[model samples]
Target: MGEQPILEMKNVHSGYGSIKALKGVSMKVMPGEIVAMIGANGAGKSTTLMTICGIIKATAGEVWYDGKKINKLNPEKLPTMGLCQVPEGRRIFPRLTVEENLILGAFHRKDKEQIKKDIQYSYDLFPRLGERRRQEGGTLSGGEQQMLAIARALMTKPKVLLLDEPSLGLAPIIIQQIFDIIKDVNKKDGTTILVVEQNANLALQAATRGYVMETGEITLEDKASALLENPKIREAYLGE
Candidate 1:
């Protein structure tokens, strides 16, 4: 058999009280690969990440992580298992300084020495964050907050990091910087990533493989390069 996926969702159906946001959504992230899920807003892209993390329960279907059924697992317990998420809005602890916010990402871990090293590594990954390590998270610019959110998530040293809408809002230059760091983290740390993005061009550019979602269902899955060149994707998502 081929290598088992680090994370897999088999026909997961999830929603908020009577609203079925995900309709039989299925996807997989292989080990050490950056798989991007690209879609428009309200396409259930974020819901997929939430369902996998157990923040939103799948009404029907299975979520498998590291060869185990994790659908029923508590969301709070996920971080200890190396499942970390950087949600859409870059939700950092507003009152906390950048360093303190990053420290909290590793709260469940016991490796004191490695945690210190990872913090420095996060700095190296985003020097802008390092420059403002002592500043309150809320005070940073939108792009800086997004960087902090990603950097904080990295502190957990996840086996598969779920990133939701990494390019939501920002200047073009800042968005490029974030995508570059996403590539950097994948190469340097070998961190497996499943990034959910509405910016199909940027997502596919950074990914090795990609899934395109529309109205809560996956309509396309292919090598990122192939998707980029696909005429339909170019028209619908890339705004050709």
Candidate 2:
């Protein structure tokens, strides 16, 4: 008898052929929430995002987005539905110019003028990106590439943005800059986020709610602040 969730997974089971990466995983993200799913390597965090986006099919259960079941929807149609994912490794087109990469994110939209405005919006979000808008994506530093990847996703004006390993391989200061932008994006754009990160410390610090996954199953979940103080979480994830 409360507001329905914006994105949810109900007893979802998925994997690569026989791998069984997720075992009845269940989670929900409310409107305007920053929900962090944290876990170690091979914990199936990335798999969860991929499955929700339809790149990895859910063998069982449901993935509900906005208000409908999307487990079976065509993967290419997800962006139009406002569920956008920025996957691991900052997968931007190497030969494409920074501006060109950003435009591709809005490939589904016909609002050419608004897309142009959003391109400016992204530059404002990451000024470094604006400086290199004409440069090839691969020529940018790792941090800049990450910025372009996020900027590209924002072009869709997604309702729920799924981020996987945004901090991976970046320097600490750059990681800080990226996370700061993530919070700003959540507040300024009012976009809900579900981030999966191996850096549990930073993820918990940024999220309002947190979920801990181990061996493909979620083992702990609570308010972000509460989880930060949790002894189990401190020892396991926070490296106490």
State which candidate has the highest lDDT.
2
Tell me each candidate's RMSD, in Å, in order.
1.2, 1.2
The 10-residue segment of model 1 with minimum total lDDT is 1-10
lDDT of 2 by residue, 1-240 (tens): 129999999999999998999999999999999999999899999999999998999999999998999999999998998999999999999999999999999999999999999999999999999999999999999999999999999999999999999999999999999999999999998899999998888988999999999988988889999999999898988889
The reply for model 1, stretches above 4 Å from the true place, is none
Q: Could you tell me the TM-score of candidate 1? A: 0.97
lDDT of 1 by residue, 138-158 (tens): 999999999999989888878
The superposed Cα distance between candidate 2 and the true structure at residue 23, in angstroms, equals 0.5
- Number of clashing pairs, model 2? 0
Cα deviation at 239, candidate 2, in Å, is 1.2
lDDT for residue 104 in candidate 1, whole number 0-100:
95
